[model samples]
Target: MTTEPTAADAVGPEQEAVETALVETVVASFDHCPDPRLKEIMVSLTRHLHAFIRNVRLTEQEWAAGIDFLTEAGHITDDVRQEFILLSDTLGASMQTVNVNNVAYADATEATVFGPFFVEDSPRVELGGDVSFGAPGEPCWVEGQVTDTAGKPLAGARIEVWEADEDGLYDVQRDAGRRAARGHLFSDENGEYRFWGLTPTPYPIPDDGPVGKMLAAVGRSPLRTSHLHFMVSHPGARTLVTHIFPEGDPIMWKDSVFGVKESLIKRFEHQPAGTPTPDGRQLKTAWRRVRFDIVLAPAGA
Candidate 1:
């Protein structure tokens, strides 16, 4: 016993009713939002999202499974790790989006995924100090410089480095003897920096999570090539988080993250020994030499 103007109702009431009900529901459900920007974002998101559903005829099964996967992802995360990042990595979304946005193809240092092992607040160590925790492996010296796109020396640039030991395991993964195979160093006035650490060996990501489950389902290995992770930053320059693989490593070109750029592959030259370091510290034995050159974008670029 609803009465409506015939002509007006034909073009308006039903259609208006449906849209009003949907948009109102969205606003009411998301009333917890505090920021105006977030409100706008949710509004537009719901509108376009509904349009997508109408266009795609999506299935409920797919949506339910997605929610289930994400729920399990949350269950896997802990204080020392993030399973969501691993999911992003396995789906190629992490590498596709983060590693591409600040890419440097022309004389600039290429970027890559900063994996889950990166911990903050690494100790500051002297140039060429051995980062090896008590275990002995190959003796190696890693030297590098941080510069800008124009090749100008960058002073006071902070280059933070961490890598797996020769056994392809990080300090956090092993026993008490595994304390500090990672540290941060600042480039001197001449833009030069160097450190003594075991050359990193290729290793695989954790194989106990859903990402690992999915990879196993697809017949893929989680192996990343032997490389060292560098997170370099300076005032006014775009921070660069990346890695360099040994050029001759068999898996260098097949890194699971697909982060390798040809220009970033370094070569390790085995040398007997060189002159005593300026600090006059002598190695217990002969060591290998690995050279790396890092290029950073201008600050605030």
Candidate 2:
């Protein structure tokens, strides 16, 4: 059949040329940016973004929907909630950024997403003090040591820890002016630190927002594995933000944020009721315990 080509069929090469030119034009627009780093970022972003659009053959309707999604995400964000971070975490962008910035050094602990839940000015607890702050969950004894990559103990390291309660909610998610299941403490002279925390339980990342809707549309689960959060920092060392997942957690392989690493998994040993705690705090209910020895890479490593 000899039929004349339609306008759409004839637009291939010319359309691609126009798109490439637009990408270059947008990229060049950042050349005058005073900040060298900002210029590099903008130029690269323009190229990748334009390539994504072209590769997907994105439709106007799809583009509009994406804008609407981001708008909702922004509209719902507040001091306690960060929809944009959730979007990034779910898309694995946050983890990739962490990987790039936290290059592996000699035995330095692997880094993971700095989840949006971390808050500043968390109450300070002494070594061996309770960080649970009366949050609801089985008692957990978390003990660890902070050391340099060379195995030298690093005393006076500030260790910040936080976790959700049994009901899968952080203190920030509750009524305003509430705090629980989070605190900061310093390592002792021996570089040893210990505190009471809730037994980490698997929970869905806040799934009631736009990010949740997107996950549902894609048939993805929003559940994070059982884990405890820690941020450790010391002089002349790279600050470490990571989570320790319990060994044998069924969902460990499917963490929604893709934060799991084999080295970060530790066994959560069970203690029978009436078992003497490390600090001799008598707890009538059975509790769990875990130890995490942290190694920090030197700054600029």
Candidate 3:
């Protein structure tokens, strides 16, 4: 004869107890954290993370693989390369962060991903000077102005610019001592600025790493559309991080990084050889030109 089950045995605690223990234990770990913000973030993250694990019934093998992938991404990151940022960009997390930080203003320049390529202290170029630094590409003239939301010029505002060469590589990807096709300049008294740069071209994000393999596994391409990156800032205004895409770039609408904004797309006009530049420098070959005026919102808005 067998004994009948008791109420405690019939109402098993395995499933519910385990999940409650996991979430409570993790959340409690942050209760003594000195920083209130950190403590709150930790508790919320723990809750969501535990919920996600329970929802997916995540297997140990899958968890191990994810850990390995993130480890590999960290292993490949270095001074000039940032695999983590690449991962964030391809996953749309970076864009989401940008959206949160950049609230809309009255016709202010839209913000986009601040990718992994920016180099501080880039060469300072004079107005109308060439930033191509001998990188191979068709000559292009970039003219723009920095203005407030009210359309008043912001003279002396800094305009930082960088872009990949025609060969789809940045200076940081090349020789250590060589800097090319990236620079910063101050606006003129009238808030006007101009510089010569290489025509933008589509390029693949560093795809020899884990993030690239993950993208490939998901049938995603790593190509970013042809565009020029700009960071415009004035003392009391919100700095704008944005890009201007060449109008006809095939991948603009489907940028792998989800960085394209309709307002940021500008038509690049092709000028045949023998055309004169804005500063009266005559071109030797066919070139392209695009004008992009920036409107900055008040800082801390």
Candidate 4:
């Protein structure tokens, strides 16, 4: 004799039909999208998003709260701030994208988030010149070279660098007409590049808005470890955006946005007081020195 059907096997056809129709309806709406890639993305997004909502058994109140949270994040964003990026970052979505895009390349400096503070049209500085603009922090000597995957120097490569001041504030975060802690320069004939910058210090990830509240609610802090940001580019090379964290930072392994990578950490050496500087800046105090070498992949790579 056959056993009676159990409750687990009692799924109704209507239930399955409703769930499948929900996804198919959303996906079909994107069928007329002009761009094939966009259509494909929308279809996948619709399916995954529906699946997520169903799997979590999301309530109407919870969905409304999520929308409100995102709306607040958008309202707080401005020219010098990016709350949406912070949301993506804290969720590990930024790092996930980086991992997918940055395939392993031997000896090449690893990439990190291009944090919200980068400003376009940064003042150009010559090699060995100071970009600090008298910003208050321990002076730092940053030197590096840009090379190809094969270890060949790429002279004249543009190198853009920026960092937060000792107080963890960027130029834009301060008063107007300030361009400190950020500059752009080019590699020399031997692929060498150098500039005077401030030693990076640990800073918070703009925790005065919605993103901060989200982090707090989830028991996560908004502090990022001390680090310097760099963008290197050459005519035939892929533009590289990354950061170098100073070794021994208290939060080095606990960056709020998950931007740190083991290969990107560098030991910053402290020079003795009154040591002669390379660029002849006439500083009368001790300073920090960081050496970073970059390798760029071919544009098509």
Best by lDDT: 2
Which 10 consecutive positions of candidate 1 have the poorest summed lDDT? Answer: 3-12
Mark the regions of model 2 whose C-alpha exceeds 4 Å error after superposition: 1-11
Look at candidate 2 and tell me the lDDT of residue 49: 84
What are the candidates' C-alpha RMSDs?
8.4, 4.0, 6.3, 4.2
User: Per-residue CA lDDT of candidate 4, range 234-282, in tens?
Assistant: 9998888999999999998789989999989998999988888876667
Better of 1 and 4 by lDDT: 4
Would you give me the overall lDDT of model 2?
0.92
Report the lDDT tens digits of candidate 1 across residue range 1-301: 9775543334367865775688679767777888989888888888777666544545699779768878888998886658888777767777888665785545778788888887786778877676665544676688888888888888888888888877777777675234667888889887888888776678888778777877888898888888888899988788888888876888876777777878788887765665454346675666667788888876545
Worst 10 residues of 4 by lDDT: 3-12
Among these predictions, the greatest TM-score belongs to: 2
Would you estimate the TM-scores of all the predictions? Answer: 0.77, 0.95, 0.93, 0.93
State the displacement of the C-alpha of residue 147, model 4, in Å, after optimal TM-score superposition.
Answer: 0.8
Candidate 3 lDDT, 179-247, residue by residue in tens? 898999999999999999989999999999999999899999999999899999899999999999999
lDDT of each structure?
0.76, 0.92, 0.91, 0.88
**Residue range 62-118, candidate 2, lDDT tens digits:** 999999999999999999999999999999999999999999998999999999889
Clashing pairs in 1: 236-299, 236-300, 237-298, 237-299
The clash count of every prediction, one per candidate, is 4, 0, 0, 0
Ranking by TM-score: 2, 3, 4, 1
Clashes of 1: 4
TM-score of 3: 0.93
